[model samples]
Target: MKIGLYFGTFNPIHTGHMIIANHLAEHSDLDQVWMVVTPHNPHKQKNTLLDDYHRLEMVHLATKDFPKLQPSDVEFKLPQPNYTVNTLAHLQEKYPQHTFSLIMGEDNLNSLHKWKNYEVILQNHSIYVYPRLASGEIDAQFINHPKIHRIGAPVIEISSTFIRESIKNKKNVVPLLPEKVWHYIDHNLFYKK
Candidate 1:
């Protein structure tokens, strides 16, 4: 089985995450797309994130209906601050029968070189990159890379940052999240100021 690992904080696992995961599963050769919920991303700030277990639960809740979409607590048990390369290594050992690929935004592809042992990741695993607003031109750097492929996924500008701010201000997030996720956020008073 071939698995595409979609790694993120999934602060609340909004609709955008669902859309991409579904798109990947429907369009790609991947057998499954696992939402690898990180306890702490090495490149991002931790203060803005919710509790790791809570974030993981939100992903689990949001993806309950999709059999191809699974929430992974793999990073939770691993060392942190979590690095994608490390998680990939761990997963390879744990699931030797399954071929592991990476599903990420074009933006993340831009920063791949800065990740630990990134060369190894590029050489070994196939990466499916969905387009995102680029901070700069890193595509040119990897244009010749053998393992990277660009995917035609919908461009969703909605982000966890926008969701957090909306919740903080008591604004409607109905359109941005799934109904169950919205209810969970409201019931837990998550991000309430």
Candidate 2:
């Protein structure tokens, strides 16, 4: 089985995420996309992040309908300030039978060299990179790597920041999240102080 690891904080899962997972599953060689919910991403701010378990739950709720897409709390059990290299190593040790690939945006691809053990990651794992508007051209140095692939999936501008601000301002976010997910967030007063 070929699995694509779609890692994210998913402060609150939304439709755009689902669309990307579905798009990858249908268009790429990947048979499944595991939405790996990170407890803390070393590259991003951690101050405003929701609880790891809660974020995982939101991802689960949002992706339940797509059998090809699954929500995984794999990084939760691992160490904090989760690093992709470590997670990939652990996953390989845990699931030897399944082939794994990295799923990310072109923006991340541009900064791949700064990541921990990036050379090893690119040499060992295939990457499915979805283009993001205004992300700038993916660096040729990184894109030239044999394992990297530039995906043609349509870009969606939806972002977790936008959703958080909407909730904070008591604005409508129905279009950003799934029906069940919106209800869950509203009931819990998530992102709303």
Candidate 3:
């Protein structure tokens, strides 16, 4: 099976994420897209993030109805910071029979050099980059790489930060989040100011 790893914090899985994952699964060469919920991202601010288990549950509730999209909690047991390189290595070791690919936004690709063991990741795995609103073109060096593919998935400007802020300000985020996710957040009083 060809699995595309779509790694994110998924503070609350929203429609934008679902659209991209579905697009990748249906349009790309991937058999399924696993939304890998990272417990902690080394590059992101830690204080703003919700608990790992809460974030994982939100992803589960949001993706439960999508057959091609699977929510993954593999990083919950991994080390802190949850580096992509380590996750990829671990997944490869654990599931040798499955061919894994990396699904990311074009913005991430622009900063690929800043990541740990990026060269190893590029050389070993296929990267499917979807367009991001305002994210510029990829670097010239990787423009023609065989393993790097730029897909035409629709770009949604909604972000997790925006969702959290809206919730804190008592703004209705029903349009941004999945129904079950919003219900869970509201019922649990998540992100209350």
Candidate 4:
């Protein structure tokens, strides 16, 4: 089984996230897409994030209906401020039979070189990149690399930070998120600081 790991904070797991994950799952060669919930880095001062469990719950709520999409707390099990290489290693170790790859936007692809052990990651796993309205170009090395596949997926502009700020300002962000996730946020009064 080939699993495309789509990592995100998933503050509320909005429709933009759903579209990308679902599109990759259904359109691409990947058998499934795992929405890896990035847990809050306790050392960071970004108080905007909801608790890790809350974000994980929201991801679960968002992905429950899609059989090809799954919610993963794999990072939560690892130490704080975890790196992608480590997470991929953990997943590989835990599920030895499954083949794991990365699902990232063009924006993230531009910064791939800066990631820890990026060369090792490229050597071991394939990367599926989707289009994004990003400022920088994807790294030249990755442009024609055999391991890198540029997928013709839809570009989603919505951001979780924007949604969180809108909710904090008492704006209606219901349409931006999944129905269950919106309800969960409303019930918990998240981001209404």
Candidate 5:
């Protein structure tokens, strides 16, 4: 099985996340898209994120209807301060029968060189990149790389920050989230601070 790993914090899974994953699952060659819920992102403040299990639950809720879109807690049990290289290596060793690929955005591609053991990643697995509203230029070396595929996914500009802020402000952000996810956030009163 060729699985595309869509890693994220998923503070609260939104419609945009679903749309992108569904597009890749249905239109691309990937057999499934696993929404890997990271415990914490090094780039973002840990305090700003919801509990690991809560976020994972939201992913499960959001993906329940989409068979090809499944949620993953693979990063939850991993050591804190997780790195993609380690995750990839672990996944490979754990699931030798299934090939795993990365699903990232154009912005992330721009900074791929700085990640630990990035060369090892490129050498071992395929990368499915979607467009992002970022200004950083993608390094030239990745332009024609056979391992990196620029999947023509729609430019979903929705931000978790925006959703959090709206929720804190008591705005109607129901449309931005999956119905069950919205209910979960509302019922738990998350991001209301």
Candidate 6:
């Protein structure tokens, strides 16, 4: 099986994330797209992040209706400050039968060299990059790489940061998130300021 791993903090899984994942699964050669919920990202600040379990549950709620999309908590049991290279190595050892590819945005591709063992990632797994709102054309270096594939996924400007701010300010987020996800957040009083 070819699985596309869409890694994220998913502070709250919103419509943009869903669209990208679904598009990858439907349009790409991937058999499935797994939303790899990161417990801790080495490059990101942990201050505003919700509990790992909460974020994972939100991903689950948002993806429940899509058979091709599923939520993953593989990073939770790993060490803190999870790195992509380490997770990929672990997953490869555990699921040798599955070929794992990466799903990311153009913005992330801009900083790929900063990631741990990025060269190894590029050599071992394919990358599916979707365009971001303000990101210009992909860098020339990766434009024609055999392992890097640029996809024309529908661009949704909505982001998790925007959703969080709306919730903190008591604004409606129904259109920005899946029905079950919004219900879960409201019922749990999440992101209350």
The local distance difference test score of each candidate is: 0.87, 0.88, 0.90, 0.92, 0.92, 0.90
What would the per-residue lDDT of candidate 6 be over residues 1-193, giving only the tens digit for each residue?
9999999989888999999999999999999999999886656777768888999999988988899998999988898777888899989999999999999999999889888999999989999999888776566778889999999999888888889999999898899999999999999998887
Best by TM-score: 4
Q: For candidate 3, give the lDDT.
A: 0.90
Error of 5 at 152 (Å): 1.0
Candidate 1 local Cα displacement, residue 133, angstroms: 2.9
Name the runs in model 6 displaced over 4 angstroms: 41-45
Q: What clash count goes with each model? A: 0, 0, 0, 0, 0, 0
lDDT of 5 by residue, 16-57 (tens): 899999999998999999999988655676776999899999
The alpha-carbon deviation from the true structure for residue 149 of candidate 6, after best TM-score superposition, in angstroms, is 0.4
Question: Candidate 4 residues 1-193, lDDT tens each?
Answer: 9999999988878999999999999999999999999988888886788888999999999989899999999999898789999999999999999999999998888889999999999999999999998738667898999999989888899999999999999999989999999999999889999
Error of 1 at 102 (Å): 0.9
Q: List the residue pairs that clash in candidate 2.
A: none
Off by over 4 Å in 3: 41-45
C-alpha TM-scores of all predictions: 0.94, 0.94, 0.94, 0.97, 0.96, 0.95
lDDT for model 1, on a 0 to 1 scale?
0.87
List RMSD in Å for every model shown.
1.8, 1.8, 1.6, 0.9, 1.6, 1.6
Ranking by TM-score: 4, 5, 6, 3, 2, 1
Q: Tens-digit lDDT track for model 1 on 66-162? A: 9999999998888767678888999999999999999989888888888899889987899999988754688576877779888899987788988
* Poorest 10 consecutive residues by lDDT, candidate 1: 39-48
Per-residue CA lDDT of model 2 for 102-170, tens digit only, reads 999988887888899998898789999998987876677875677988889989989999999989998
